[model samples]
Structures are given as C-alpha cells and as structure tokens.
Target: MQTILGANGQIGEELARYLHNTVTHDIRLVGRRPSAVNKTDELFSADLTDAEATDRAVAGSEIVYLTVGLPMDSAMWEERFPVMMENTIAAVRNHDAKLVFFDNTYMYPQTAAPQVEGKTPFEPRGRKAAVRARIATRLQEEMDAGRVEAVIVRAPEFYGPGKTQGLTNTTVFNRIKKGERPLVPVSADTQRSLIWTPDASRAMGLIGNTPDAYGQTWHLPIDQDRLTYREMIAIASEVTGRKIRFSTIPLAVFTLAGLFNAPAKEASELMPRYGVDNIFDTSKFAAHFPEFETTNYRDGISQLLSP
Candidate 1:
C-alpha cells in the first residue's frame, strides 16, 4: 500500500487520485487534517510533528511521500523543518517504508539557465533553501547508510486552479484575479521553467515506482518552452477574455515593504530567483518514462481559465 503524508494539498491530492484510480494501489493519506481529503478508503488525520502520533499514522505503509512543509520564516525552519524532517525520517524507518520527497529547486545552485542534477556551486543562501538542502543531503546520507530507500524530485514554479493562495498566488494568478497587472520580479523577458501540477505529480509517482530512480534526484520534466511574463499575461488574458493590465513593481519598494512585514520580506528575498531565468533539463526523468508528456504552457494557461 502507498501512503501520502501531505495528501490534502495539491500535489498530494493529485498523487492520491492517480494511485487510487490508475495503478489499483490501496492508499493511506496522513496529514495535519488528513480528513481534508475526506470520504476516502484510506485517509487518516495525523501530524508528523508529533512522534507517537506519526508512528501510528504511518504504520502498514510500504511507500510514503513527504510532500509537507511550513512557510513561517527562517526561524521556523531553523527550529521546525529539521525536526519535521527528522520525525518523518524516523517514522519511515520505523515503518520500514521507502520515501519519495516532493521537492523544489531552491536547494540547487543558483542558475541563470538550465541546471543539471550534479552541477556545482552548491551553496544556497536562502534560509529555506539552506534548510531544504540540509534535509535532502541528509536523506541521501541515510540512503548511503543502507537502511531506507529514498528519491528526490525537484519542481519549479507551478500554477493552475486550486493553487489560489501562498507563494505562486502572490505573484501570478492572484494578481490577475485582482484585476492588477502582476509584477513579476524577474526580467520581463526572463522565461521560467513551469510544470503543471498533474505533470509534476506524475513525475513524482514515476520516481516513486522506479527503484533505479531511488538514490537520485531528478528535475521535473516540462515542455521547456520559455515565455516572458508579458507573454504569459497575454496568453492568460487571451484565454480568460480579459485584458490583464500590466505593471512592474520595483524590488526596491518590495525591500522596504519587507522591513515591516513577514510576507513581503519572504516574498522579496525570492525576487532574485524570479527576476532571472530558470531553465531546467528533465532528460533524466524522460529517459526512464518515455510515455511522460508535459503539458504545454499554452494548454496550462487555458487550464487556469477553466472552471
């Protein structure tokens, strides 16, 4: 049986649905309020932050997906994330389950274009990035220790329906919904690698099922077409039949805003990443799953307009 730790969230929900409907696998979902994924065959509510609770929640599972995290701040990571990672590691080990971590690119070296799996300049300055790097490296270390199996898959910026809050919303679709031209922090022309959630979830599932993919990190496969924020706005507007007014907010002002607010502070720090280009190569994943087809940017844009 497969179990998803953060199964109530976007990727988690997609992963659960896929496993339940396609692969004929019995599944368990554990979370802060796993009941959020209610009326299912194997969904349980539990918090991994609590050890005894997590141990009970994770029992009887062969594979577990650690797709959970917090967004409080640097201090939170220094105090909370590691504990969460440690707790999860312990839980998986206790249950003798393999782990598949749904990760992001923040841990990778800062790059202006496509990044390879084993590229250099490993220093990550973002507080959250640093924490993520530590957790990932430790997971790999544990794998080398030969007790548990693990695989990491990193994803870039994502947007679609149901992701209406948090980081992505602050920059993309939310602004458009507010009738404001979204101020993309990156260069107006900086094209970013974006994976639709379903594609990313599928990639994660594929990695979870492949033993060869264990002990390795793979970037989520995408269509690789680069489109500027302006181009994105044009496509979104075209699809929605609503002309999105365009504007650019200077990062300098954002810095000032961050001085008195946590959200703005966290948002501003990520400005550098968005202000540049993030081109990712998913050749490794593609090689294993030749049937994988990433949704095009245009098709994804249209999905955002769907009800």
Candidate 2:
C-alpha cells in the first residue's frame, strides 16, 4: 500500500484520485482528519509533530509519500517544519519505507530568467529561502547515509482548480476576471514558470516509482515555451471570455505594502524576482516520464472557469 502523508492537500487529493482512478495502488491517506475524507477506504489520522501519533499513522506502509504540510511564512518554517520533518523522517526510517518529498525552488538565489538545476551558488536572500536550503540539505544528508530512499520533486508557482485565495485565485485570476489588468511589477514580456497541480501529482507518482529518481532533485515537467506573465494573463482572460484591463506599476507599491502588511512585507524583498523573468528547465523529467504531459494553458484556464 502507498501512504500519502498530506492527503488533504490540493495535490494530495489529486494523487489519491490518480492512484485509485488510474493506477491500481491501494492508497491509505494519513492526515489530521482522514475519516472526514469521504472518498477513501483507508483513512488514518495523526499529528506528524507527535512521535507516537506519527508512528501509528505510518506503520505497515511500504512506500511513504512525505509531502507533509507547513505554513508558507518564514517564521513557521523556522519553528514548525524541522520538528515535523524530524518525526516523519524517524518514522520512515523505522518502517524502511521509500519516501518521496515535494519541493519548491525557493532556496535557489535570485538569478536571471530560465533557471536550471545546477547554476549559481546556493545563496538565499530571505529567511524562508534559507530555511528551504536547510531542509534540502538535511534531506540530502539522510539520503546519503542510506537512512531511507528519498527523492525531491521541485515545482514552481501552482495554479489549477481548488486554489484558495492567493496569487492566482485572488490576484491574477480575480483581476483578469473583472476585466481589470493586473498590476504586474515586471515587464509584460518577462517569462514565468507555472505548475498545474494535477500534472505535479502525476510527475511525483511516476518519480516515486522510478529508481533513478531517488537521491536526486528532479524538476517537475513545466511548460515547454517560456510564456511571459502578461501572455499568461491574456490567455487566461481569453479563455474566460473576459476583456482584460491591465495596469503596470513600479516596485514602489510592493515596498509600501511591505511596511504595513505581513505578506506584502515579505513580497518587497523579492521584487527583483517578480520583475525579472523566472523559468525552470524540466526536460529531464519529461525525458523519463514520457507520459507526463502538462495541461495546455488555455485548456487549464477553461477548467478553472468551469462550473
């Protein structure tokens, strides 16, 4: 049986659906309230931060997918992730289960557009980035020591169905839906990387089953063409049959909001990144997971707009 650690998440639900609906694996979902998940036969609940509870949740599973939850803010990473990961790691080690960890490219330092896996030195600028580097290093150490077989599947900014109020649903999609152009800080021509959550799920599952994917950081398959953020917004607008009214702004607004608001406070420092074109190379994953096809941008937008 395959155990999905954060089975209540957007990607987690997709993973469960894929495993049950597509693959033959018997998925046991482990979360805070697994019984509440009406779709699954095996549901287990426990707080990964608690050792005994985590052990009980993970026992008897051969493959433990460790995509555990943690807050996005910098402070939470400092205080929460380490303890939860340690407990989960110990449990994975005890059970000798293969672990697959989800990751993002936060730790890589700010660089030019189209970032590859191996590039500039790992110099993170913010508290969250530093913490991500720490987590990656810790995972690598455990993997090197043969404590547990592991793989890190890195993804980019995610947007698909079931997204809550955040960058896409709140900022980008909302503005475009209202016929208002988003206040993009960067050039309208800056390229960006976006991950469809379902695609990420399929890629993760494929990697989990592939032995070569172990002990390596595999960039999940992303769009082949580097589309500008403006291009993305325009396509989303077109798909929704909504006329877009765009407003480009200077970096001053982000700085101003950072002074008074918390999420904005964090956003100001990363203005260069938002303004600069950011992209990732995932040809390696595509080569391996030949069936891992990403959804078309226009089609994905339509899916989100669907009732």
Candidate 3:
C-alpha cells in the first residue's frame, strides 16, 4: 500500500489519481480532512505535525509520499515545516516505508541560472526558503547516511486545470479567463520554466515506484520550450480567440503594494524571481525517463481556458 500525506492539495490529489490509475489501488490518503480520489482509496485523517498521528498514517504503507504545502506565510512555515518533516521522516523510518518527497524551488537562488538538481547550491534568501533548505538538507543527510530509502522530486511554479494556484495561474490565466488584462510580474521578456501539475505528479509517481531512483534529487520534467510572459500571453490569446493585453508589474510597484496587502507581502520574497529568467533544468529526469512527455504552453493554456 502507498500513502500520501497532505492529500488535499492539487499535487497530492493528482499524485493519488496517477498512482491509482497506473501504479496501485491500495492507496491511503492522509490529511486533516482528505477525500478519496478513487473508490479503492482508504482515508486517514491526521495532522502530520503530530508524531503519533503521522506514524499511524504510515503504519501499513509500503511507500509514503510527503506533499504537504502550507500557506505563503513565513512564520507559519518556520514554525511547522521542520516539525512535520521530522515527524514524517521518523514515521517513514519506523514503518519501513520508502519515502517520496515532493519539493519546490523555493530553496534555490533567485537568479537567471539554470537550476540543475545537484549542481545548484542552496542560496535561500528568506525565511520560507531557509526552512525549505533546512528540511531538504535534513532529508538528504538521512538519504546519504542510508537511514531511509527516499527520493526528492522538485517542480517549478504550476499551471494547470482545476484549483491549481500559482503566480502564473492567478496573474495570467485566471485574469484572461475573467476578460481582464493579465498582470505580468517584472518583465514579460524573461523566460519561465513551469511544470504542468499532472506531469509533476506523474513523474513523482514514476520515480517513487522505481527502485533505482532512490537516494537522489530530481527536477521534474518540464516542457523544453520555455516561454516568456509575452509569448505566453500570445498563446492564450490564440487559444481563447481573443487578443489579451497585459501590464507588467515592476518590482518597485509590487514591493510597495506588499506594504498594505497580506498576500502580496507574503509573496514579496519570491517577486525577484519573476523579474529574471527561470531556467529549471530537467535533463536528468529526461535522461532517466526517456519516454516521459511534458505539456507545452499552447496546449496547457488551451486546457486552462477550456470549460
């Protein structure tokens, strides 16, 4: 049996679907309140921050996935993430279950550099990033020490159908769907590397089941044809059959706006990334999983705009 911790979010939900359809039906969904994605899934409501609760959630599982996501608040992340990670690692170790960790690029440096899985060193800039770096480092240390069998799957920002939330989805796709001008952050010319949510989940499912993929970090496969905001807007326009115009939010303006807005204030640390090219390299994944196919911008945008 495979178990998913924090199964309510988009990534967890999608991963459960993929595992059910392709890998196994004996899946356990664990969260504060997780609904089964498939009829065969067993639901166990538990807070991962609690050690006993987390151990109970992983007790009977052969594989465990850690895909928890918190709010954009730094203080909340600082307070909860480490505890959750510690509990999860302990539970997985105690249960003798292989772990699959779904990670993000938050710990990566905010720059135009290509984010290769092992080559890029952690240069986390803020509290959230620092927390991410710490947990990921702790996980790696465990992996390196052969204390647990695990693999890390990292993805860039998301853009996909259904309740998927991200900067691109909120600023661009949602706005275009609402017949409003899209808001581009910083520059429209800098290229972005976004992973389709399902693709990220599918890749993680594949990696988790593959024994050879353990003890390493992987950048989830993304469409090779990265696009800038200007190009992305053009694709959306074509897909929607309407010209879409967008206003670029400069760093100064975005930073100033954060002063009075809670969400914006929480996102200010990541705002620097929107200004530069985000080149997330997935050559390792491509090389390992030669048959995996990623969704492109035009097709992804078409799906997002579709009813």
Candidate 4:
C-alpha cells in the first residue's frame, strides 16, 4: 500500500484523490486526523518528529510520500525541518519503502533562465532557502549511500481550489471576492512561474511509479508560458465575470509591514522572486512522463473560481 505522509495537506489530498481515482485503491493516509478521502483506509496519526511514531506510521507500506508543510517562520523551519527529515528518513530506511518527496523551488538560487533539475546551483538568498538546500543535500547523501531509494519532485509556488494560504488565495482571490484591491507582492508586469497543485500531484504520482525516477531530482509540470500578475488578474476577471482592482505591494512596504506581521516578515526575503523573472523548465519531466500534461493559467484560474 502507498502511505501519504502529511495526508491532511492540500498536495496530500490531491495525491490521494489521484491515486484513488486513477492509480491504486489501496492507499493509507498518515496524518494527525482521520482520513477524509473516499477510497483510503483508516488514517494513521503520529507526530512525525518522533522517530518511533514515524516508523510505526510507515510500517507495512511499500511507497511513502512525504508532503509535509512546515510553519512559515524561518526560525520554526530551521528548528523543525531537520528533525522531521531525520525521523522520516530513519523510518523509511527501516521499512525499505520508496520515498517520494514533494519539494519546492526555494533551494535554487536566483536565476534568469528556466530552472533545470541538475543544472541549478544551490545558492540560497535567505535563511529559509538555506534550510531547504541543507535538507536536499542530506536527502541526496542518504540516497547516494544506498540507505534509501528516493525521488525529489520540485514545483514552483502552487495554487488551486482548496489551498488558502498562498498569495493567490490570501492576497488575490479573497480581496477580489470581497471587492477590495488585490495586494500583489510584485509589479503587475513581472512574469513568473505559478503552478496548479493538482497538476503537480499528478506529476508526482507518475514519477513515483516510474522506477527510473529514483535517486534523481525532477521538476514537476508547470505552465509552458510565463504569466504576469496582470495577466492572471485579467484571467480571473474574465472567469468570474467581475472587475477586480489591484494594488502592488512594493518591497519597501513589505519591509515596513514585516515589523508587525510575521508572515510579511517571512515574505520580505522572497522579494527577489517578484522583482526577477523566475521560471522553471519541465522538459525533463515531460520527456519522462510523456502522457502527462500541464494546465495553463486560464484553465487553472477557472478551476479555482468555480464554486
């Protein structure tokens, strides 16, 4: 059976749905609560930071999918991520299960070109980025030592129907729904990579089942064309049949806000992405998973706007 760690998360739920509907029916959800998905067995709850609990949760599973989302604060991430990784790694090693880690693009340094899997260098711009880089290196070290079989599937910032903590939902969608100006983090003209969570989950599923995907890092499928915040706003306006106002939150403003707002404090370090052209190259994933397709912003926006 396939075990989904952090099963209550957005990506975890999406992966569970994909597996239940398209791939396998015998799936076990490991989370802090009961299973909410229709086709999953009973949920296994445990604090992943506890190695014994993690080992218990992962036992008897052939494949373990790690989709954990840590708190946003850099200090919290620094304190929690290593412990979780070590415990999970030990558990997966004990069970000899294949690990599919859902990773983010934060580890990659600022780049003008589309980020390729093996080509991007690890040049962290901030504390959070450094933490990500370290975790990735640790995983690679374990894989190289033949302690575990693992694959890292990375995606850019993700948004979808149910996700509410991201810029799309917290800053854009909610403001537009409430008839307020969307608090855009960057200039409306700057283009960057944004992905749909469902598409990323599907790409992860395909990669997990592919034997050759192990011991390598892969980029998940993202939009072929880069899009600006203005373009996305226009798409949302068209899809929802409502005119939306937008106010770009400048870097200086975010810095000031950071003094009182913890989330904004964490976000200030990410301003480089807003000011630069950030893109991801999924050609490697496409070549490997020929049957998979990415969802464009237009369709993705429509899906998010749907009731």
Candidate 5:
C-alpha cells in the first residue's frame, strides 16, 4: 500500500491524485483531517509529531510519501519540524517502507546563483531556512547510513490552480483576478523559477515508484523558460484579455509592515529572494526523466485564469 502523510496539502493532494491515477489504486491518505482524492483511498488520521501515532499510520505500507506542510511560523517550524521528521524516519524504518520526502528550496542561500542538487551548500539565512536545513541534513545522514530507503524530491516555489499558496499566486494571480493592481515583492525584472504544482507531484510519483531513484536528491522538473514578474504579468494580462498593472513592493516596506503584522513579519525573512534572480536548476531531473514535459508559464497562467 502507498500512503501519503499530510494528504490535505496542495502538494500532497496533487501527489495523491497522481499516484491514484497513474501508479496505484491502493492509496492511503494521512492527516488530521483528510478527504479522499480517489474512491478506493484509505483515510488514516494521525499527527506526525506523535511517534506511536505515526507508526500506526505507516503500518503495513510499502511506500510512504512525506509531503507534510506547516504554517509559515518559524517558531512552529522550529518546534515541530524536527520532531515530525524524527517520527517519520522512525516509523518508516519500523515498517520497512520506502520514504519519498517532499522538500523545498528554502535551505539554499537567497541568491541569484543557479541552485543544483548536491552542489549547492546550505547557507540558510533565517530561522525557517535553518530548520529546513537541519531536517534535510538529518534525512541525508539517515540515507547515507543505509538506515532506510528514501529519496528527496525538492522544488522551488509553486504556482498552480486550486488553493495553491505562494507570493506569485497571491500577489499576482489573485490580485489580477480581483481586478486589483498586483504587487511584486522586490524586483519584477528578476527571473523566477516556479514549478507547476501538478507537474511537481507527477514527477515525485514517477521518482518514488522508480527503484533506482532512491538514495539521491532529485529536483522536480520546471519549465526552462523562466520569466520575470513583469513578463509573468504580461502573460496574465494577455490571458485575461485586459491590461494588468503591478507595483514592486520594496524591501523596506515589507520590513516596516512586519513590525506590526505577524504574517508580514514572518514573510520578511523570505523577501530577499524576490530581489534577485531565482535560478533553480532542474537539469538533473530533466536528464533523468527526458520523457517528462513541464508546463510552461503561458499555458499554466492560462489554465489558472480560465473560467
């Protein structure tokens, strides 16, 4: 049986759909409250931070996917992420199930340099990034020690339909849909490498099912034609059949707003990434999965804006 931990999240939901449709029908969805993505899916509700609960969740599973996500609170992440990771690793080991971990690019430095799997060093700047780096390192150490079969699938920010949350989706797409002026984080001219949510999930399903793909980190496939915010807005404008205007929010404004706003304060740590080019390299995944086709910006934007 294939099980998905944190099955209610955007990534987890998409992953479950992909697995059910393409890979297996005997799927299990684990979360505090999870709705079935397919008719045959088994619903297992458990808090991953509890060891025994996690063990029960993973019992009798052949392959487990960890796609859990928490709110953007650094304190919450610092307190719970490690415990959840430990619990998951222990549970997966006890059940002798292969683990497919879904990870993000937060641990990498906030710079314009092309982020490559295994080549980029962890130079995390904020509390959240540091926490991500720690958990990821622990997983790698477990992998290197031959403790459990696992594969790490990492992706940059996400932009897609159906409750997808990100700076781009919230600030750009949602604003445009509401007929409000869009807000660009820092520099609208810097290139952004975002992965379509469905594509990322599809790639993860393929890699998790492939036996030889374990014990390595794979960057999820992304469209090669990275676009700047200005260009992205242009595409959205074209798709919506109306002129869309956007204003770039300077770093100082975000920082100032953070002083009084909890969400804004939490988001301040990630503002640096928007100021420069975010060139996430997926050449490794591309070479490995040559048959995979990524959704380009124009088509993806069109789909999101479509009625």
Candidate 6:
C-alpha cells in the first residue's frame, strides 16, 4: 500500500484516485482534513510537522508520496516547509518507504527554454525558492548518504478538474465559468505552459513503482505546444460555449494594490513568470517512461469544463 500525504490537494487527490483504481485498493491518505478521495482508502489526519504524528501516518506504507503544499504565505513556507520535510524524511526512513516528492521548478534560475532536469542551476531568486532548494538539497543528501531512497518529480503549473484553487482557474477559468471578465496577472500574449493534473500524478505513480527512478530528480512531461494566455481563454470559450474575455493586470498594479491586499502583495512577487516563457523539458522522463503521454490543453480543458 502507498501513503499519499496532503491527499485532499490536487496532485494528492489525483495520485490517490489513480492508485486506488489501477494499482491497489489499499491506500492511506494523510492530511488534516477528510479527503474527498475514494471512500475505500484509509484517511489518517495528522499534523505532518509533528514527527511522531508523521511516523504514525506513514507506518506500514511501502511508498510515501509527499504532495503537501503549505500555505502560500512566505512566512508559513519558511516556518513549516523545512519542518515538514525533516519529519517526513525521518518517518519515511523509519518505515523504509520509498519517498516520491512532488516538487515545482521554482529552485532553478529563470530561463527562456524549458528547464531541463539535472541541467538547471540551483540559484534561488526569492525566499520561497530558497526554502524549496534547501528541502531538495536535504533530500539529495539523504539519498547520497544511503539514509533514504527518494525521487523528486517536478511539474509546471497545473489546470484540471479539482484544481479550483490554481491560478488559472481562480483568476481566469473560474471567472469565465461564472461569466465574469477574467482578471489575469500577465499580458494576453505571454506564452506559458501547464500540465494536466492527472498526467503529472500518473507520472509520479510510474516513477514511484520504478526502482530505477529512485534517488534522482525527474521532470513531469508537459504539453510541448505552448499556448498564450489569450489562447487558453479561447479554448475555454470553445469548450464551455461561453464568450470568455480577459484583461491583464500588470505587476505594477499588483505592487500598488499589494499595500492593501495581502494576497495581491504575495502574488506580485511571482509576476516574473508572467513576463517570461516558463517551460519544463521532460526529455529525460520521456526516455525513461516511453509509454507515458501528456494530456493536451484541448482535452484537459474539456475535462475541466465538464460538469
């Protein structure tokens, strides 16, 4: 059986569903809330920061998938992320469960092309990036020292069903669904990439089961065809039969608004992504898992738009 931490979240929910339906019925979901996942799987609510609680949550699981996302606030990330990682690492080691970490590409320095796995520099540009980099480095050190077996799976932005909290959905698609003018962070012409949550979760599942994938980092395959934010709205319009239109809010606007809006202030720090083409190269993953495929935007958008 496998344990899925943060099972109520996007990737965790997808991973739990994939495993319960395809791999095994015995799955354990670890989180502080009741999971919306399959009812058959066990739900163990515990604060992962507590080492004893994490140990109990992970006991008896053959593989532990760490999909926990702390609150978006930098203070919360600074305080909780490292503690969670250390506790999780210790717990997994105690139980001898293979660790499969679902990570983001924030640690690497900004680049024009897709950031290649193992090729990107670890030059952090912000507070959140530093924390993520340190956590990844800690995991690598554990693996190098033979203390634990682990694999880090990095993914781009996510958009799919059950992803209502994501940026695209919260700021754009959800607004489109509600017949409101979408408020986007970047310009309409800016090109960016996204991954269907199921596809990313499936990649993690595949890597977790592949012994050869242990102790290394892998990038989850994404749609190679990059699409502009305007084109994304067009796809949503086509899928939902709604006349979706959007307006862009520049970083300066968010910066000024940040003085009054806490969320906006936090969001302004990430506006650099809207100014560049953020792509993730998954050639290594492709070479490792030849049969794996990425779900394109058209199909993925259709799924998200469906009732």
- Tens digits of lDDT, candidate 1, 1-307: 7888877778887787777766645788888777534345486888677888778877888888888856647887778667777888898899899889888777666658568786633567678778878887888788889878888888876765674234555677677766676766646677777778888887788788878888878888888777877788888888878878766667687889889998888767667766667778878778778898889889987876655
User: Which tens-of-lDDT digit does each residue in 1-307 have in candidate 2?
Assistant: 7888878887787777777766545778988876433355488887887988887777887777777656557787788677777877888888888888887777766666566665535677788778777877788889899887898888877777773323555566666655666766645677777787888887888788777878887888877776776787777767776666566656788788888999887756656666676767888877877876788777776777654
TM-score of each: 0.92, 0.91, 0.99, 0.95, 0.99, 0.95
Better of 2 and 6 by lDDT: 6
Stretches > 4 Å off in candidate 2: 35-38, 118-121, 164-166, 178-181
Candidate 3: which pairs clash? Answer: none
Instruction: Per model, state how many residue pairs clash.
Output: 2, 2, 0, 0, 0, 0
lDDT of 6 by residue, 168-282 (tens): 8778877776678989776787777788888989889989989999989999888888888888889988888877867998878987988999887766666777777777788
Clashing pairs in 1: 186-274, 186-275
Task: Supply candidate 4's per-residue lDDT for 129.
Answer: 91
Q: Name the candidate, 1 or 4, with the larger lDDT value.
A: 4
What would the per-residue lDDT of candidate 4 be over residues 164-203, giving only the tens digit for each residue? Answer: 3576677876677666788888678878788788898888
- Decide which is better by lDDT, 1 or 3: 3
lDDT of 5 by residue, 85-157 (tens): 9999999999999999999999998999999999999999889999999999999999999999999999999
In order, what lDDT does every prediction score? Answer: 0.76, 0.74, 0.93, 0.84, 0.94, 0.84
Q: Write the per-residue lDDT of candidate 3 for residues 1-307, one digit (tens) a residue.
A: 9999999999999999999999999999999999989999999999988999999999989999999999899999999999999999999999899999999999999999999999999999888899999999999999999999999999999988776879999999999999999999899999999989999899999999999999999999999889999999998888888888899999998789889997888888898998899999999999989999888888899989976
Q: TM-score winner between 3 and 4, please give it.
A: 3
Residue pairs of candidate 6 with colliding backbone atoms: none
Off-target runs (Cα >4 Å) in candidate 1 are: 36-39, 164-168
